[model samples]
Target: MKKISITFLLVLISLIAQAQFTFKGTIANYSNKRILVKIDRAFDDILIGNITTNSNGSFSIPVKDNYSGIIEISLLDAKKNYIFISDNTDIDFSASITTNDEFIINIPGNQINERYQNYLNYDIKKNSILPQLQNINFYYNSKDDFYLPLKNEIQRISEMNEPDISEFPFLSYYLKTSDLIKNTEIGNGDAISNKNLILDHFKNAGQQFETSGVGKSLLYNYFKLSAMGATSQKDWENKIDKAIEVLLDEVGEETSRGQEILSATINFLNGYGLVNLTDKYMKRAESLTCEISAELKKTIQDNNSIKEGKIIPNIKFTHKLNDKYTYLYDIKTKYKLIMVWASWCSHCQQEMPYVKQFYENFKKSGGEIIALSVDYNKEDWQNAIKETSWLNDSDLIYWDSKFVKELNITGTPTLILVDQKNKILKITSKISDINNLIK
Candidate 1:
């Protein structure tokens, strides 16, 4: 039989089971501080591990594959309390005060935390409940009281819990605002056919996570982002050559250096999906990033491991803004972005109006965007850059900033960019891709 149906479709295309789970337990009243157990790690940010509480008050931590996270337990007589864990469910508890006690025995049941909580409930119903119902109809003109709470938050992201349409970017920005609210002629006509039936129920809930193969790079990046927003240059070069042959066979069998940095972020999203479908797909996305940097410079010059471009890894951080701070090859910028933030981040306050509109359009086409502010506070980084006028070159580094301990930058709206001989063209969290270096 066709070789047992091609060995059952290569055992169902390498069934990625156990998305992660085994948060071994024991956290009972810090027998001298050391709990930091963080977990959210599949593709960057959050994975510190530690456990110490035995002088009669246990502590243990290990969690992977039932993904949804946030399990902080920091101790010194209890105050750190971020606990949301959904899916591979074991979480033993007992945190006390007035003479302390903390315990969380064992937790396991992660069917990849119901598939990373249906890709974080379809990215909190397309970036926080349909962009907070278009910012409450752009400050209250009530689209019939925000259209049935935006179809009950797009039916709570079509009943969330397994919706990993290949790292769904808010289910491709709610199917590109449901084709501009379905072939325009703006708003109501039954609220644009109930916003095109909640973007045709997130395009049939992304074909049930593309029939459970968990979003083959989000179904070839929502068909090369709906054929490059309908300019369909030959259907966005046949969906960026089937999403760069399934992201170059999942970035050459990603055997986890965190899935090889999510296979170099699916080869920088297949080189920005062939630089948005042709200058011959940006010369086949710069020849697939020069054939993965000439097969990682012929496997690092056949294992001598340090030449072909040695000037690459330097990113540390720690300049501690004022109390005397200046690291990051000690300040000087013709062009620099460095950015990174945290003041109880709301996507670092919605990426400060796209990094203050790319630092006022890269300083009116001259460029320089420092910003730093890891906020240990010099008045919450001068009241969030004086309520976000965000004129560039602001600083306040703290969080141990020698460019965040040479770019270990755990996370918080990370940026980087650098130039005028600082070199690095991008590190990106995509605030309008730092105008691809003064365009």
Candidate 2:
């Protein structure tokens, strides 16, 4: 019976206008590198800007005029990212990649970051060493000569705790719910042995932490692991229902917080490829005595929109890829490929040329490629499609376009294959897989 605060259901997602601040840094060995700055919005990221290091590997960029909180730095590759908290002070840091490939950051004149960095270093060490030691201990005989010292070291490290920098209130709460911490029995490769513990953590973690990106990850990972542990599909479905029941227990059923939680859970399931579990959420929401909000209901409806064998909504061609094809349904082709792409995504750019090359063959088979751009800028969308004559259009709403969410275009270059009736035949990211489908 832990307390779960319902303030905003997202404290970090909404940018607060704190006193202006900037983050100054130096990256070792990577000079003049383009970096992607993003702020956490629950499970999603709002792109801040692109920054590049100077020749000396030094860079300075203001966090944002009205934003201060959790930020992600994607250096070069999208995955080689690190997190930092910017406060009232000008934070300075020096960073480099470790031999083990962990991003090692050290911020001077900031005890909060100092403590956090120490914990990251410590966590990486523990993650690297402990599991192997666990296997050794599992395999070796207790009477072995190496057992005593190895066991003692393992015990000491396991008992050791991160330095208490809880004096910084927000960070203290953040660490509690962060993906790096296993107090919730959930993280990468963490087995969900205790479902109650995760629910308890979600309940106990305050509004600020529980409503952030870390919170979303915990819930997503919990469901993923739980789904794996289920004895059967029926068992999995039951667990999903039971989880929602416990989370909503004794809480204000009519409140938006409950609704937001349900919405987030549904999105998480969709992101995790748990299509069947997503259907259950709408069922649960609809059957409830209290009226579900339009937003929540819309989320459920959108998720169900593009299921396999479901006829997708017919789209008007605002900027038709082919001048001959005025609407999505107007195409006389036997099959269609809905290429949901964005202009800014490098991966999408790479995929476009291949898609263009494949279009002729696909068209010969009575299949047409309908390019749907998810760009918010009309000019950008136009520039991107200059080379292709596919039947296409962009709402210019980025991801907020109704169909983008409905069709579940989670990333750029998502290919949705459908028949003449627009019944979704296949949805995949790989171009090679769908090549066989067209033939």
Candidate 3:
């Protein structure tokens, strides 16, 4: 799993899926625009592919997935996404203006998507459209000729059965969770009841749900719902703790699912400025069983060093800085703010100035900045750091070098603070983490 980015989803696909497959589709009236293919990894999205539509509005890009999985295709110009489910074959769709608001289409060759659309249409009418019509009947025109036909049509569709997806287990899991999400959507009546329902679903969400795309949505929405009406910081954190604690009761910290949910929760909290809660949960994760998969461990641990209080060595850089220092050992300071980042990362770009400011603030007080670039292109790195003067170097190997392997650089803008003696003082991502540790 990659570092948590925007969107919440999970797709723990079946074992028979291939590492790479083609996802081809046509988008009418949307030509020559960038399209991003992405998958849910609980806390963040894994960008599988990026391609621009042809002048004819058609696109075909390679996607990494198992035979069966879920992915979201993002239209950069339209600012919209269409969710798709796979069933071991190449999944294709034909889209246009008529399907603008409705992304789901049950066209030829995609029975899984058809069934999913059936549920989506059914739920909207029964829960949203049906309720609105009932409001009109009770208040506006109960005896009008227009009312009778409209009511009957709405009633018929609302009472219709949901799509039968018994044969496809992936579709079944997705839709069932979709129904629960609809029930707990914001502005639904009975806030108290919906909150309890969210908590209950959090407890019952198993690997089938956690490993799929919608799994992340459950946790994402729960965090939003919990913080909807907080009057105080204590209340906000208490609500978050309540939901997380409920989930922990069902899954232990040692299990993969447990670690995933916990890691997702921590990343979300940290992103939203709940650093204290983030620390509390991260410490808890660190103490769990270390037998989990290495890829999964990156999401939680976010580093490769012997955590805190340990001497961190093997800090190597490829180029010389100002024709002087090349590694952490060469820096003459009591504390070192080591920044591991890539030029292409948007988040890293946003946080660079603050790190530079921090380094300047502490420069005279025994501090130095050592930037480790994971950029394979030297020009990109040079352009990125053109205005800054700091110790910069890279192997230009991009996550495959021994330097990255030894450090286990979790994600871009991975900022760590260590002393001259190579003792790692802190491992953090945000300025708040550094300030919190130093102060």
lDDT per residue as tens, model 1, 110-226: 443344345555666776676666555445444677667666665665565545445544334434433443433233344335433433433344322212222333333334343
All models: lDDT?
Answer: 0.47, 0.69, 0.69
Model 3: per-residue Cα lDDT over 76-130, one tens digit each: 3324667887665676778764544444343623777777777778878877788
Q: RMSD, model 2, all Cα superposed?
A: 10.8
The estimated TM-scores of all candidates read 0.24, 0.61, 0.61
CA error at residue 219 for candidate 2, angstroms: 1.1
Q: How many steric overlaps does candidate 2 have?
A: 3
User: How would you encode candidate 2's per-residue C-alpha lDDT over 202-285 as one tens digit per residue?
Assistant: 555555652246756666656655666688978887777677666767334576666767877777666656767777776777
Candidate 3 scores a C-alpha RMSD against the true structure in Å of: 10.2
Scanning candidate 3 in windows of ten residues, the lowest lDDT window is 6-15
lDDT, model 2: 0.69
Regions more than 4 Å wrong, model 3: 1-21, 62-65, 77-79, 97-109, 134-152, 155-161, 185-206, 221-231, 303-439
Note the clash tally of each candidate: 43, 3, 11
The ten-residue window of minimal lDDT in model 1 covers 302-311
